[model samples]
Target: MTAAVTTEHREHYLALVGHGDEAAAVDYALGLAECGVSPRDLVLDLIGPTQRRIGDLWARDEWSVAQEHAATHVSEQVVAALAARHRPRPDRGVVVVACVDGEWHALPARLFAEVIRWDGWDVRFLGASVPGPHLVSYLHRHGPDVVAVSCSVPTRLTSAHRVIQAVQDVGVPVLAGGGGFGPGARWGTKLGADRVAADGRAALEVLRSWPLRAVAEVSPLRDSFVSDDEHVLVVKRGAQLVAVAMDRLADRFPAVHGYTAAQREATEYDLGQIVEFLCAGLFVDDVELFRAFVSWLCVVLASRRVPPETVDLVLDVYHDELFDFPRARAHLVAGRRQVPAGRQVAA
Candidate 1:
């Protein structure tokens, strides 16, 4: 049965976890569970929101990385405590939950696994970043009803396609989730996944209705589609791209020019993400994948008091560097469109 989660209850859990009070947070969640609040609500309502808030706090500079990591640890403890008290009914069929290769954000996948287990499905939670070969071997051995693939970052979409194809080759259907799959599961469908779930509840609904079938020969999408030499070329030159962009940004923007070693490294990391997401967008043949990331990057830069035009400068640098690659140039053009024209640095 689904339990009601009051706003007060939600805020209470957030306060406990945010303060690094893992014991109190775990106790508070367990208390709610004992009161009959569904484990699903505990995950989706309390812990899930808290995790997002942690990221928001860090992005706004209100919380340090240490604080974010500590808060995440607290949330993990709460989930662990909840899983210990609740036992699966075992009447529902088996499901395997795992993060795609190269995806380290395992909390969402962990929460989804526990919620599915509480909903009566037998779950084998394979933690984070399960390699393709190992995952296929596990599926062959256990043969679960469905596989839930979780991805949190857009950069991992290429790896996700590989995982989706690998699981499908063994005749197992995949339900892709996480922000990495892109808004509305756009990339998931393009990657040829059987289904996509926006959240834990939606994942459960899809799993319930999924059709079972025998293992058959499922052809891989990568082979059928035209070769993605553009993606490969961009990825192969990722380091050079970041290096050149970093040097150019420092020359073009005073803020970047005066950055400390740590700040320069951060700038380098951002440039690297731009290149990676660009490649990922190319891989999926979708402009929105790169566009969405640029939009979000603008917001993050604004939060840090950096001019969003810095993103424009980086895009311009890439345009000059990759002029030979028309497809890459086109994706960069789409990304630059998302940023506003005026350059106003936050003070």
Candidate 2:
């Protein structure tokens, strides 16, 4: 009976948010709490998985940005209602949660914060993309037992690395969590976090075992890059590469030449995203990162009626332009391989 109810609730909750019915969703979550659903389960089980599905819906092109945003906002409201209803006293040590710089997805961090708060730790959630320096200052002022850094998008891994290093430098142990850290969050260890968790529930287990770990005992950041300068050079030259790709795209597509200002801007943004993802893949020394991004980009573009072959051309131009950067070229090759063989190289 409990399993049946859980399934029904999951389906109903997803439907509520999908339609942007925030008040109803919040009511439903709170009603579950009233009906003996543990607050922790409400967050980690219901809101968290639903939020991820919202992301997946957007990724699969089944939902537009507006719909995704609406669904996400509803989830946030549900989380808040639950948290407000069950504010456990902070018996455990204080812990701060923050999204890494440039990671605007704060819901994951918020989910962790609410869960830990219910578990009795005082959670200070620094919402949405706190800069490293500012975060360090917050740590100094508050002196939490640890800080959990969240990064959802892989492109923000460089910023995550910097923030982890910066937080550890200031005598605080860092707990790295979020999707950006790659599978199993192996990249989090590479970035020098004291501990890593793949999600809020996993983070809870990590904190329970070692909530007050000292700074000096944490693992130092590993040197993951083969050519450290390649990622940096890609970022530094990103604008130039985008401009070059744009010009070349106009030549190949011809349609780009007739693009309106909005169209041109959007194209530039897409090209820039390609470079950004490439830089991230290089930063983490993972070809799979670039390949994954190319595959997803293909789906996104295809859903929007843009030719996936455009990504192929962009990769080719990037490969040619980054000829001097061996690592960059190699990752681009991986990304190129992800593009469906829509057209042959333009000789």
Candidate 3:
């Protein structure tokens, strides 16, 4: 029987995890298990939200990378504890859970594996960034009923598409999940996945209702975006783009000019991500892909007390640099519009 996950219980678990007390967090989870809180709810309700909060805290600068890593480590321990307590039923079908290549966020995929195992599926949880060829080799050897791919970062969508196709080539139906797939798994369908789940619970429901003899579709790789040479140009010039943007940033924002080594490196990383996402968006031929990232970038910068206009300035620099590339120019312009105007740093 599933126990009730009251707000009080949730808060207690979150507090323990946030404090980086792995033993305390595990004990708390075990106590809930003793009280009949189902393993599924334990993962989805308590651990899931706590991990998300950790990410949010990091984005807002409320937590350091070390703190975030420590908290995530605790969550993983909690999941292991739950897994030990719940034994799988042998009669259920086998399912393989993994993250797409280049996606280092493994907790969500781990949570899904635990939830599905609790629901009686024999889950093989391949943690973190399984390459396409390796995943295909596993499929040929194990022959699971379904393969669930988890991707958290939008920038890895291109990799996700490759993994999806590779799995289908081996005749395994693929279930795509996570934020990288876009709202409602719109990108998943475009990538030729058999199904898309919003979360673990939803994934379970979809699996339950899935046809027994579903044949994975073999679709040709979509090539409409390949003809756009602008993506290639931006990728080839990425380093130059970052360097020029940094030079222009120093002129526009005094804070950037006086940044410490660590701060300068962080800013450089941020600029690199912008270029990468732009190229990824171009590869997918979806402007919203880049636009959504810009919106999130604005929030992250605002949280760090930096002017959101920094994104606009970067985009402006790109516009001038890529002026001859029509598609790249248009996408940069669209991204610039998504960033709301904020206080400009005095130069």
State which candidate, 2 or 3, has the greater TM-score: 2
Error of 2 at 177 (Å): 0.6
Per-residue lDDT of candidate 1, residues 63-160 (tens digit): 88898898898899889988888886778888899999989989999999998888888999998999999999999999998888999987888788
Q: For residue 156, what is the lDDT in candidate 2?
A: 92
- Model 3 vs. true fold: TM: 0.91
Clashes of each: 0, 0, 0
- In model 1, the clashing pairs are none
lDDT of each: 0.83, 0.85, 0.84
lDDT of 2 by residue, 195-302 (tens): 899877788899899938555576655433234777998899999999999998999988889999998999899899999998988887889988889988888788
Q: Give candidate 3 misplaced runs (Cα > 4 Å).
A: 216-229, 254-260, 342-347
Model 2 spans > 4 angstroms off = 1-5, 211-213, 220-227, 342-347
Residue 57 alpha-carbon offset, candidate 1, angstroms:
2.2
Which lDDT tens digits does candidate 3 get at residues 75-193? 99999998997887756788899999999999999999989888888889999999999999999999999899999987898799889878877888888999888888777767777
Residue 65 miss distance in model 1 (angstroms)? 1.7
TM-score to native of every candidate shown: 0.91, 0.94, 0.91
Clashes of 1: 0
Please, what's the RMSD in Å of model 3?
Answer: 3.3
